[model samples]
Target: MPIQPGETIPSMKLTQGTPDGPRETSIDELFGGKTVVLFGVPGAFTPTCSARHLPGFVEHADALKAKGADVVACMAVNDAFVLDAWAKSQGVGDKIVMLADGAAELTKALGLELDLTARGLGVRCQRFALVAKDRKVAHIGVEAPGAFEVSRAEAVLGAL
Candidate 1:
């Protein structure tokens, strides 16, 4: 089963890009003492991920923050370079934090790993959105494969 409400985010490090290069950060450091909206994508720059999923959060970031979310972040199974490039391509800037779960460790820890080897995508994180308050999950929306209803930004903001 995937991570559920009331459960704390798993303690695993994820990489993020910076001027100095890639920096590894743990879940606690990202979510602890903060109300954060973390959304995961199968891959950065992919169709739905780039076209809709990620953009939704970026568009609604201020609304989410006004609703009490401290940070709005986007996570993917790609490396820091790829994520950083995608963020730039999308003009994300400071609107959202781009997280790189390159090793799938955090996805596996959350029980949300999706096997896409059949499609030549290899292992990936499922499409999902979560509200973590002080490192604990408060709301979660996981979409079925190829679906985008529940994990959209509007739904997550409504939950908040």
Candidate 2:
């Protein structure tokens, strides 16, 4: 089932890379005692993702922070290198936390995995954003296929 508002996130270890090396970050570790804005994209560097989705957040990082987001993070079903590079290219390395769900573990756990074999894109994440406080989801915005309405920074800000 898709995760819903007021539900505690399950304890799942997701891989992310820092300046040092790749490591595991648990759901609790990420959401515990924090107000977080978590957004997922289909893939790194894809047209819609790069042109619209991720950029919206990157452009509004300060606004989001001002609205009580302790951390704004972007996740994709790609490797750490791709995510890191994407963040740097967007000039959002300092603003957004880039997380890699290389094996689609986190995507599947959230029931947001998309099978894009027809597009030759393999497994990807559905576009969505969640406002989380203290490890529980406060609001969830899931976009319809090929739609960029709900998960945009503007939408998330309204939710906040």
Candidate 3:
């Protein structure tokens, strides 16, 4: 089952591409003692993800922080290098933290893995967003296939 509200974020290491290089961080390190809004995409630089999903968060990042979010993060199954490049292309800068779940370890831990092997995309994370406070989930929005309503940044802001 997918991770639900009130469940603790599982202990899983995820890589974040930083100016200094790739840094490996655990779930607790990211979400502990913080109000985090984490949104996941199937892959970085994809059509919908690049056009709307990510840009929304980038635009509303300050609003989220104003609403009490300490961290706004974006995660994908792509590698740290690819994520870093994409972040640059999007001009993400320090507005959002880009996480690379190269092996889908964190995605699987959250039970949000989407199988796309037949399409040659391999396994990817489903489109979703969650609000986690102090390492525990307070709200979750898992988008239905081909739909983008609930997981949008606006929705998460409203949830907060």
Candidate 4:
């Protein structure tokens, strides 16, 4: 099963693309002592991910912060370079952090891995979002297969 409300975010190191370069960060470092809104995408540049999911978060980053979110992050199974480029393409700047779970380690740790090997995409993270307060889940929304309602930024903001 996936992570649920009240569960602690798994302790795992993941890469994130920064203007300086790729940096290794752990879940605790990202979520500890903060209210974090983290969203996972199947891939960095896929249709729904690029067109709606990430953009939605970017559009609402300020509102989310205003609502008490200390950090807004977007994670994908892609590498740091790809994620960095995607962040640039999306004009994300410093508004959102781009996390790279290249090997899906954190995804599996969260029990939110979606295997797409048959489709040739290998293993990927599911479309999901979670609100974590001080390293524990306050809310989590995992979308149904091919669906995009529950994990939208608007939905998460309402939860906050």
Candidate 5:
């Protein structure tokens, strides 16, 4: 089932790269004790993702923080290195957490995986965003295919 507003984030491992190497980050670890704004993209560096989705959050990170968001994170189906490079290219800096859902573990757990096999993109995630507080989803928005409405940063800000 798709995750809903009252549900806790799924217990699965996502990844992030540290100077040491890539490592696991549990869903609880990311949303366990804070108000987190988590957004997922189909892939890192894709046109829509790079040009609009991710940048929206980066530009509004401070605004979200001002509205009581403790963390603003962006996740994609790519590995940590690609996510990091995408962040750097967008000048993301420390404004957003670049999460790597390399295995599509978290996306599948949320029932949001999109299989783009015909396009050779393999399994990926749909564009979506949510607010989680102390591990439970408080609000969420999943975009329609090829649409960029409810999942954007402004949508989350209005909810906050």
Candidate 6:
């Protein structure tokens, strides 16, 4: 089943590229005892993801933080290097945490994995955003396929 509001995120390790190097972070380590805004995209550098999905969050990171979000992050089914590059290209590297779900482990665990093999993309994550506090999801906004409505920063911020 898909993860629902109030469900505690499963323990999983994700890769985040930092100036020091690639770091491994667990759900507990990232969201435990913190209010977090986590948004997931199908892939890094994809058209919609690069243009609207990510930029929306990037442009509103400070506003979301001011609304009580301790951390604002973006996750995609790509390697750390690609995610890092995309973050830099978007000019939001410092504002949003770019996480790489190299193996789709986190996406599958959340039941948000979408099979796009016909498009040669293989498995990808659905576009969604979650407001989490202390490792439990407080609110979830899942976008419909090919739609960009709920997961935008303004939408999630309003929920907060």
Tell me how far candidate 2 lies from the true structure as C-alpha RMSD in angstroms. Answer: 1.3
Return the number of clashes found in candidate 5.
Answer: 0
Our tally of clashes for model 3 stands at 0
The digit string of per-residue lDDT tens for model 3 on 1-160 reads 8999999998789999776779999888889899999999999989999999999999999999999999999999999999999999988999999999999999999999999999999999999999999989999999999999999999999999
Residue lDDT tens for model 5, 12-131: 778975444567787778788899999999999899999999999999999999999999999899999888788879989889988898889889988889999899999999899999
How many clashes in candidate 1? Answer: 0
lDDT of 2: 0.88
lDDT of 6 by residue, 78-108 (tens): 9888988888888986899988999999999
Q: What is the C-alpha RMSD of each candidate to the true structure, in Å?
A: 0.9, 1.3, 0.7, 0.6, 1.3, 0.9
lDDT of each: 0.91, 0.88, 0.95, 0.95, 0.89, 0.91
Cα lDDT of candidate 6 equals 0.91
Residue 25, candidate 6: Cα error in Å is: 1.3
| lDDT over C-alpha atoms for residue 145 of model 1 | 76
Model 1 TM-score, 2 decimals: 0.97
Can you write out model 1's per-residue Cα lDDT over 29-95, one digit (the tens) per residue? 8898999999999999899999999889989999999999999998889999999889888889888
TM-score of each: 0.97, 0.94, 0.98, 0.98, 0.95, 0.97
Prediction 4 TM-score vs. true? 0.98
Which stretches in model 3 have alpha-carbon errors above 4 Å?
none
At residue 144, candidate 6 shows an lDDT of: 85
Off by over 4 Å in 4: none
Candidate 4, residue 137: Cα displacement in angstroms equals 0.4
Error of 5 at 7 (Å): 0.6
Candidate scoring better on lDDT of 1 and 4: 4
